[model samples]
Target: MSTGPNRIMDEFAKLMTDAAGAAQGVRKEMETAFHSQAERWLNSMDLVKREEFEAVREMAIKARDENDALLRRIEALEAKLAEKGA
Candidate 1:
């Protein structure tokens, strides 16, 4: 009689363990599917990735800085020319 109850308890514990493992697997599958779908949808929307946006932003900043430097050079050259004329 004692052996029978112990056997039943062992079987129940194994079943619970299997159930927990299956639940974890299902959870992982669900998370993967959700992430895949989200990425696909975002791509379809044609959004710029962060890296691309940052690159473009850096280019624009560089161009602006160059423009400022060029403008200052032109102004200095004009001042020299005016001094020579006077």
Candidate 2:
């Protein structure tokens, strides 16, 4: 009689363990599916990637800086020309 109860308890523990493992597997699959769906949705929105945006931003900054430098050079040349004319 004692052995019978012990055997039943052992079987129940195994079943619980298997159930826990199956639950974890399901959780992982759900996470993977969610991630894939999110990525697809984002891609469909025609969004620029971070790296590409950064590159374009840097180019704009460079062009602005170059324009400022050219403007300064032109002002200095105008000043020189006025001195020459006078």
Candidate 3:
């Protein structure tokens, strides 16, 4: 009777250890799946990530500034033309 109880306890302990390992593996798989799905969604939307968006936004801002400067020069030239016409 004593040996029988010891063997049962040993088996239970092994089963518990195996279950724990399986659960950890399942957790890792879930994490990987979620990561893959999110990446797909982001890509499908044609959305730029934060870093890329910031770089493009900076370029746009520079272009807008340059355009404004050009507009001012054009207005100045137009004024000179009007003066010559007068």
Candidate 4:
């Protein structure tokens, strides 16, 4: 191969490599900025964390279960009272 063609090809390869490196750097910077902006936006809103939400959900479920049990117990007691009165 002629030196001229080889030199041109090497220069083209180096340019492509440099461009790829620059693109990667830009991509990383964009990702970091996007994440920062997203974090700021999220912080601006009032939101519950997953753990807190799950805790409240569990408390509600437990309260509902207890209420159901109490209701059933009352019904049973009422039935027993009627049987004795009759």
Candidate 5:
């Protein structure tokens, strides 16, 4: 009688362990599927990566700064020319 109860308990513990392992596998599969779908959706929208967007933004800022510097130089040259003429 004692051995019979121990055998039942052992089987129950094994069943619980198997169930927990199966749950983990299912969870991983779900996460992988969700990530794949999200990537596909983002690709369809033609979105740029964070690094690429930042690079383009930096380029634009640099170009604007260069333009402002050139404008200032041109104005200074014009003022000097006017002074010479006067």
Candidate 6:
């Protein structure tokens, strides 16, 4: 009364396919819910995003460069003044 090898394999294949489909559905739902929650939390926080932070950092670097140039100019002016006084 036992089934043949082919029938057993067919049943097993069906079971595996059903399990894979169920897992995919669960993954999609979890991904959607996670994104929704993450967006809400990110919006609630008044934080600068990565892009904005990077831009500000670049600006700071540029400002530092300009400040260094100004310092060099001031030193040169002071040196000239000392020579004139000597």
What overall lDDT goes with each candidate model? 0.98, 0.97, 0.96, 0.95, 0.98, 0.96
Please, what are the lDDT tens digits per residue for candidate 4 over residues 3-69?
7989899989999999999999999999999999988888789777799999999999999999999
TM-score for each candidate, following the candidate numbering: 0.87, 0.75, 0.62, 0.72, 0.88, 0.72
Task: For residues 1-86, write the lDDT of model 1, one tens digit per residue.
Answer: 44788989988999999999999999999999999999999999999999999999999999999999999999999999999999
Query: lDDT by residue for model 6 over 1-86, one digit each (tens)?
Result: 44799889989999999999999999999999999999889889977889999999999999999999999999999999999999
Which lDDT tens digits does candidate 3 get at residues 5-34? 898998899999999999999999999999
Model 6, 15: alpha-carbon shift in Å? Answer: 3.3
* Candidate 2 stretches greater than 4 Å from native: none
Error of 3 at 17 (Å): 7.1
> Which candidate has the highest TM-score of all?
5
Q: Model 6: clashing residue pairs?
A: none
What's the true lDDT of residue 4 in model 4? 92
lDDT at 16, model 2: 100
Q: 25-50, model 2: which lDDT tens digit per residue?
A: 99999999999999999999999899
lDDT of 4 at 3: 79
Q: How close is candidate 6 to the true structure, as a TM-score?
A: 0.72
What residue pairs clash in candidate 3, if any at all? none
How much RMSD separates candidate 6 from the native structure? Answer: 3.2
TM-score of predicted structure 2: 0.75
RMSD of each: 2.0, 2.6, 3.9, 2.7, 2.0, 3.2
Model 1, residue 84: displacement in angstroms? Answer: 1.9
